[model samples]
Target: MATIDLTSDAFEKTVTADGIVMVDFWAEWCGPCKAFGPVYEAASEKNPDITFAKIDTEAQQEIAGALEIRSIPTLMIFRDGIQLFSQPGALPGHALDDLIDQVKAIDMDEVRAEIAKQTDEPSDAD
Candidate 1:
């Protein structure tokens, strides 16, 4: 599948859907973002099962601000509506492939349980 452009209106629905969703936060003016574009697009084609999307920081400032994105070419991965990975920098093709493998290997049952535990715990503020 090809990468899709994500806008503010579609951001929440797209990321919260089932299956794996990879989001690339980028800007037109950023050198790193330009360099990473092709890498990300190629990965999208390689991983047809995953939803690969991009948010142009310059055009989608609202979404960027809401996500607290401070850097260009920030990559975030979500699986079954749960975010699994987020980091700055452009990943090499090999590293991106490795990351996809790791995300696929994750046991979401364990992840959900962990989330439940954290949410159930008493807060330090209390």
Candidate 2:
């Protein structure tokens, strides 16, 4: 239930885990990132079922670059190995909680069908 620091090696396995994973991409020098830290931590304790991880942008340059984290506080949510949400900014505790609720309520079966449809669609290059 405690928030874990994520390194490049831990990133993949953490996100690809079987359940909800919330990752906060942040840096110590960032004001917003600092402000959001406690809020994120509080949520982590409340939502024990979700894996809460933080990636320090300064230390984990490779992982930050790979993810194209242009901002200090980027929030990403992964469920069942599918990245359902990615947003750049700090979220208030209430808003973050609301988002978690929304993500949990998603119809993954429809989402999977939509992904399949998009993948199966022919390209326009022809």
Candidate 3:
């Protein structure tokens, strides 16, 4: 799939709508984000099953704030509305491809169970 631009309003709906969603948080001024752009776009074409989305932090400050994006070219992945992975830095094409493989290989059932466990556990705030 081609990389789609995401606004704050569309972020939630796109993430929750289907299978895997990968978001690239970026800013036009960042050099690393520029380098990673084609790599991310290529990965999107190679893995058409996944949703590849981009958020321009400069334009979508509200969404970026909500996600607490600390750096440019931060990558986030979500599956079934559950965020699976997030990281900062520019990945080379090979590394990004490897990451895609890893994401595809994950067992969502176990992920869900872990999420439930974490939520069920008492917080220190209590």
Candidate 4:
């Protein structure tokens, strides 16, 4: 599958609100980014149900800044408006595939339970 060109203005709609959107933060001059390109594309093709996008750090500085993308070829996974994972460095084809599979297998009910636990904590002053 071809990489979706993501711009600063389109980040929210494309990745945030979209279901299971994976954004690859990279730059044209980064060697690791170039190496990971094919792996990212192949995974995208294999998973049509998920949206895959790429944000060029050089071209989309604002988006990169907002996401605090400090390294090239960072992969950020956002599911249903929540950021599930963000990692830097290049991943092998199989590794990338495994990452996607793991994310898809996550139990959303458990995820929500964890979120509730964090939010339900009482103040310490009491």
Tell me the tens digit of each residue's lDDT in model 1 across 44-108. Answer: 99999999999999999988898899988999999999999999999999999999999999999
lDDT of 1: 0.94
**Clash pairs (backbone) in predicted model 1:** none
2 against 4, candidate with superior TM-score: 2
Q: Give the TM-score of candidate 3.
A: 0.93
Off by over 4 Å in 1: 124-126
Q: Write the per-residue lDDT of candidate 2 for residues 1-126, one digit (tens) a residue.
A: 499999988899999998899999999899999999999999999999899999999999999899888987999999988999999999999999999999889988898899999999998899
- For all candidates in order, the CA lDDT equals 0.94, 0.93, 0.94, 0.89
Location of the lowest summed lDDT over 10 successive residues in candidate 2: 1-10
Clashes of 4: 0
Error of 4 at 122 (Å): 2.8
List pairs with backbone clashes in candidate 4: none
Tens digits of per-residue lDDT, candidate 4, 17-106, equal 746999999999999999999999999889999999999999999888977889999999988777899999999998999999999998
Candidate 4: 10-residue stretch with minimal lDDT = 10-19
